[model samples]
Every structure is written in C-alpha cells, then in structure tokens.
Target: MARRGKKAKGRPISGWVILDKPKGMGSTDCVSKLKWLYFAQKCGHAGTLDPLATGLLPIAFGDATKTVPYVMDGRKTYRFTVRWGVQTTTDDTEGEAVGTSDLRPNADEIRDLLPNYTGEIEQVPPSFSAIKIGGERAYDLARSGEAPEIESRIVTVHSLGLVEMPDADSAVFEAECGKGTYVRAIARDLGRDLGCFGHITELRRTTVGAFTEEDMVPLDELIDVADENREELDEEAIESGAKARILDFGPLDEYIIAPEAALSELYEVMLNDDQAGRVLAGNSVLLRGRDAPAFCDEAFATGHGRLIALGAIDQGSFHPKRVFGGKG
Candidate 1:
C-alpha cells in the first residue's frame, strides 16, 4: 500500500491571540470560536480552564502553537472568590453541594490561614477534573458514579493573599503559582483549615506566563469583526453577531501578536546569514559576538525580520533545538 500525505486547508494564520474568556465557555470551545473567526488552519490554547472559570486564555494559531508549551510552563496569577459554608463535588460552584456548615472566619483568621497555602504544599485535585485515571478522564468517572481516589501531589504557590471579603459568605483571593497548582483545590483546603466548608464561587485568571489581562480580547468583538467583513469574507463570513460598533477596517490586525512575543523573557539573538543557514540545516554554529551568551538553554533566532528557530547555546556555540520555519 502506498501512503499519502494529508492535505491541510483554511487560512495559513500564524500568531498569538490572548482571549478574555467569558464564564461558561470551555477553553477548547473558546479556541474553536477564535479559530473559526480567523479561519486558521491550526489553533490551540496554552492551558485548560474549567467552564465555571473565566479570564486570560491564550490562544495560539498556526506556528504560534509551537510555543504553547513554553507559556503553559510559565507562572500564573489568579483572583478567585471562595464561598464559605459550602463544599461541592467539583470544588467549584458548578458542582453539587456535598457538604455545608454555618462556620465563617473573619479577616484576621483568613489572613493567618493565607500563609499556610503560600509555599510548597501537598495538594489533592478535585474528583471531578480532567486528570486521567487509567485511560478515562477523572470527571467522566465521577459522572458515571465511580469514586476515584486522587492522591495528593506537591505543587508550589509562589504567593497567596486574601484580597477581600466580598460578603459574609464569600472571601476573595489572589494567588500567583507555578504549573499544576489548582485554585479550586485551594478553596477546598482553605475551608478545611478555617472550620467551614468552601468552594470556588468565582474565579478569574489575571495572568498566564507572559500574557496578561491587557492582551485579552472579548469573543464578541472578534466575532463582530468577521460579521462586519462579511462582504469580503463571502460565504465563509461569520454572521454570529447581529450587534457591534462597525469599523471600515478589518480589526484582526489590531488583535494578532507576533509569535516571537511569546519568548519575551528569552533573549533574542539575531543570527547572521551563515549561522541562520547552518542552524536551519541542523548544524551547530559558534558564537563570538558581545551579545553571545554566558550560556543559555535557548534563545529565539531571527533573520531577515522573521523568527528563524529556537537555538540552544552552550560554551559559546549555538544549536537549533526547535525550528520555527516551514510550518506550512
């Protein structure tokens, strides 16, 4: 049998899109919406956010998707509301109430408890979650009436603070954490420490890696653009929106961020023609310039105003670890 290469269609879009995800929309659903509006050939989100959670969701299109792992590994900051006296199946408001209480802690007590969650700790994820048990999703097992014992794992919380007490029944929190740290689990544990059952009433991610609230765009606004450009988009035009402030120019240019922007923390070292050629051809090149590294694990390479590849520098030599070109 002769094997054949698969064909790809749709716009060859390549860039980063930060979406201010609205509540009730799954992260995948939000990415799908963005992909459809842009008509991109490929798209994916940096991280998964539960339907009950909202805020900064980074969506990468085409070549930008290659950098998603970098963003996912970066630190994240969140602002969440914990509703005391209620513990739920999922540890969030969307889940059914599993336990309740009349206990509520005051500001001094809450502040005292904040330090307990601020450093390295063993945290157990909620039963209703995306974690895999055997081959099936943990959430699926929970929905099917199975009690899957989720073991505790070590997670780092860079910082955790009590933002405010919105009401007698709720307390707001701000947490900046490393990868795999769940805000929902924090609420669950806090209630246990404060003598009141707790669950996340509301949650918003303020930051994810290098992307922040300032970079996010609302879904309605993006959809509105596709609607306004219907005449040019032809039958492929998105008409999901019936309202918006119409503009003569297409709004997409204003929203797209350069794929290289994802490597803002990484020092970019523009390679010469020779170095670029050698790196692209899967060969190592020497670094002798003033900008040459003491030694870095990786640096974004650029040539002729284009992202070339992610180069690995060691002992003043550069090697191409991940190529960014020819993504089509």
Candidate 2:
C-alpha cells in the first residue's frame, strides 16, 4: 500500500498582523511566536527587521503571503540615530568597530550634506546584510571571513533630514525611502562624507507601504490576551458551564487585519457577480465601463467588497492571476 501524505497542521487562519516589533527580537522569531499563538497553518513577514531595530513589521498569514511582494515594494520611513565617532562592520551596533574619528558634524554641517544623500543615490549595502552573494548570504560570508564584494546600486531616498543632535556623539535623522534602501548605509556614507566615521546606534522603522505606526499591535499585548482567555476557558470548563470553546480565538480575531488591506495601493476594478465568478475560476472578464483603465500592469478585482483576484488589465479586459477567497 502507498504511504499516506502528511496532514497539514494548525488552523487555516488568514489575515495581516502589524507587529510593533520590540528591540532584541529577530523578525523570524517574532513570526514563529505569532504562528504558535494564533495556531495559524502559515505565517510570514513582509519585511525583515534587525535584532537591534524596532517598529512596524507586517506579519502575513495564509493567502496573505501572496501579497508580500507588494508590501516590500512600498515606501519605507525610518528614524535612526548615527553615532558619529565609530564605523562598525555591520553598520549598526551589533558589529565590531572597524573605523573611528574625532570629528563631529554640527547641525548646519549635517543639514548641508543631506541633499547629496537624498533623491537617487548610489549606495554600497553593509557587508553584514541579507543580500545574497554566490548563492550564500552576505552576512554569512562576512562572518566566515570571505569578505564578499558587494556592488553599489541606485536607491531612492525620497526625503532625508536631521531630526536633532542629541549630543556631540550622535545625531538623529528621519528618512522616507523606496525599497532596498538601507538606513545603515545612510549613516555610513554620511559619516564618510562629513569626515566623522559613523554607524547606526539606533534604528526604528515607522512605516511600510499602507501599514503605519497606528496599525501596530505589540507582541506582549497579544500574549496577554491569549493567556487570559485560556485561563478563563479552563475555569469555565471546570465549572461545567463552558460558554465558549477554548479554540474560538475569542478577542484575538479583532487584531487580524483583512488580507485585502495590503493591496490598497493597487488599481481596483469592481467586478459583477458573473465577472467575479469567472475571475475566481481562473478566467478573464471584459471591463465594460468607460471608467475602466485602458491598460494597467497590475490591478485587483473585488465583488461586493470581497477580494476576488489580482492581475493585469489589457485592452479593457481584466485577467485573473491570483484568485482569493471571494467566490461564494
């Protein structure tokens, strides 16, 4: 007889969770904890936050993972502090100091230099980064002493300004940049230009795509609710008056943002019932309205406020690429 296939585990929960990641927790570890807490069958993060960094980390469960690329492509906002006297291997506090300087830049001097780093600029990512080289992670290569050569790439920095100079040793700055822009590289390059070798002492991501500071739910808050609800369930069971099932999610469902929220930036095409059915069946439907886009590289269709598919519009026809839970 043929061996049976392995059964899938956990609940088929699907949605987005904007985690206000605390310092000292890796992004992967945070996702793992969330998976266990929610008992979700699948979980993934939209962006990676360093162990030393903190702020908005969008966690995706189930089908929401299909939209991760869109979130990653969105603009990112960060407020980081640069320690002006040292340059570290990792470009942040976690690495050894490889260079030092006594010269510290004043506010006026830093202000004058901001324009050069803003808009489009060429940057060499920190050696200790997630960038892959030769099918191996750059950080791993750096740790193994392979000293990988990373090429400089063009990245957009929409805005960059000095927020304040906390002391002679550090300067706080805020920036809004496009994908692939590294905050560490900003500090490193700025320090080199100012003649005051620097590295990021503090880093915090304030926004990514449609997700913002206001959307974040801290890890501890979720844990607290999970524990409290479980205790209540146990007590009710002992009393033989169980009003709710232990696995019912209780108040935890409130934190799950709908998966369609991640696709807000994409062009929206409203589909009729027939269109929605066709789209859900992996078929294309003719867009009948004059308001319909002539052509679009990417667009999402929704029927009665429910996400149906993600695809492109060409010649007044909407093609379905990725179908979702919109078919009734």
Candidate 3:
C-alpha cells in the first residue's frame, strides 16, 4: 500500500468508505488496511464487527471520523446462520465447543419463536467482546480466567424474518435491530429456550444505518481498485471517491455530497453566516429561521437542537462545527 506523503503533494482525501469486510479479519485491521490504501492520516470504523462476522463496515477517513458516532447510532440489519445442538465458549464458531445437545427445534417451532425476539428484548453481550469491565476489556478479563459479571442491556429488534431453514439443526435469519443488539446472544438464548444450546455458525451485517452491503466494496476488491484519478484529493475528491466507490462507482464531481450530507437526516435550522460561525464556535444558537416541518421544536427544546449539525450557507462562507472535516 502506498503511503500518503507528509508534505501535501496532492490534496488530502477525506470521506466515508463502505467496506464489505471479509471474515477472519478484525475491524481494526480493516481500518488499518484502508488507511494505508488511501494514504489517510486518520481513519476509524463506525462500529466494531467480530472477526467471525463479515459484512458492511463503514470506514471513516480524514474528517469523516468525526461523524462516525452519528453513523454508529443508526440501525443495523444482519443475515446470520445459526447451528443448533452445540454451544461454543465465545457464542460463535470461533470459540471452543463447550456443550452439545441432540434435540433440535423444527422450522415451525423456530418460526413461532422468532416473534418472541421481535421488537424490544434484553440481551447480554458476548464475554469475548470489547466491552470494558473495571478498566480492562471484557475479553481480556475473560481470557485472564476471571468471571466478569456482565449486565444485560435492553436492545430493540425491529424485525426478524426467517430467511431459510435448511434443516432442523440449522437456520438462517434476517434481522433488523437497533444498536447494541447482540445476535450471538439471541442465538444463545433461543437455543436455551428450545432445550438445545446453539451458537452463531455464520454472520454478516447486511446494513448499518443508511449504508448497506450493496454499497460495500469487498476488502480484497478495495485493495485491488486503483486510486488513479489523483487530481486534488481534498474534501471534494474524498467525497467523490466515496460516492463513486460505494454508491455509483462512476466519475463524480468533487462536491458530490457536501459535509452537510452526513447530517441531512437531523433537524436543521439554516443560519446566517454569522450564526453559523457562532454555532461552529460551540455556542447554542436559537432556531429563528423559517419553520421546517421536519424540524421538531420539542426536540430542539430538549437539546435536540444541540444534536443539530451545521453547514455553510454557500460556497466560501464558513459554518461552525463542520462535523465531517475539521476533526479528522
């Protein structure tokens, strides 16, 4: 991978990269690969995916890292296949087999059980996870032979549909879930309820917020793809490159999507250049602009306005908190 030179020989590249992460690679490893591939100074992933899990992992390069949190909050959809009658130490196939059961639930029985997991449910994260416990990673503690008590958290499963039931011993499911929903936990709990222990045999993230697997580039393909159109790789090139790579894979204008594109879903109040400056300076600006039906006053009243992000009124005019670029 070619490294970006310290001196700005070309423009700096910055934007999101939708990576179709391959299994057996950690999220951090994927980010590092992209960082090297693009010659980016700063790069981070919106969310972590276990090495056993593969699918869409959004990589934020340059300024896009600042908006990673916003993207992380978005809902995720996954397609996972679970094998019944066996339980692994880590809940997924990556771990040692800890237990087994002979009995397996039928497809009809599984469909009946799926509804119970739909909507809101309580889940405990896997022990072999990045969760911090007493200032140490939970996985580290677990690996150190410590029994760390993990608290169960409430997570939402918006929808769960059975995609395929090949046999009584295995099933494939498509699930739309809110942030923090652990699919491994669901598999474990489901197996427990069915009188058979189970673990995730395979998992792939289908969607994360607005990004989807269809929008993702395979990690190998990304490595193979050449960054040849190396004009000025500034914000414009970065944005254009991301759109081209993820959305269209065609030539795009430097400004295909503005910095504000990251925050278009949030309620916004257009500010004058001066107000924009103040907002950028970290001051809370009142909503005085024309009322947008999309803008909720109650939400704004309760610091939802603070949740709002800023953008320039026009070209050359500056807005405070250009959330996409400045921080990275």
Number of backbone collisions per candidate: 0, 0, 2
For model 3, what is the error of residue 254's alpha carbon versus the real structure, in angstroms, after optimal superposition? 9.0
Deviating ranges (above 4 Å) for candidate 2: 1-5, 231-246, 325-328
The estimated TM-scores of all candidates read 0.91, 0.91, 0.75
Candidates' C-alpha lDDT: 0.85, 0.90, 0.70
True-structure lDDT of candidate 1: 0.85
- Candidate number with greatest lDDT: 2
User: Per-residue lDDT for 71-154 in model 2, tens only?
Assistant: 999999999999999998999988998999899899999999999998999999999999999899999999999889999999
**Model 2 residue pairs with clashes:** none
RMSD of 1: 3.7
Candidate 1's residue-wise lDDT over 1-328, tens digit each?
Answer: 9998887766776788899899999998998888777777899999898998889999998888888988999999999999999999989977898899998999999999888898899999889888898998889999999999888999999999998987899999899999999899999999989999899989999898999899988888887776876554334344754433233334775688888878888878787888888777888788877867868987878765667788778888777788876542
Better of 1 and 2 by lDDT: 2
Taking the tens digit of each residue's C-alpha lDDT, what string does model 3 give over 56-83?
8888766566667667888899999999
For model 1, the stretches where C-alpha displacement exceeds 4 angstroms are 1-4, 232-250
Question: What is the C-alpha RMSD, rounded to one decimal, of candidate 2?
Answer: 3.6
Task: Give the Cα-based TM-score of candidate 3 against the true structure.
Answer: 0.75
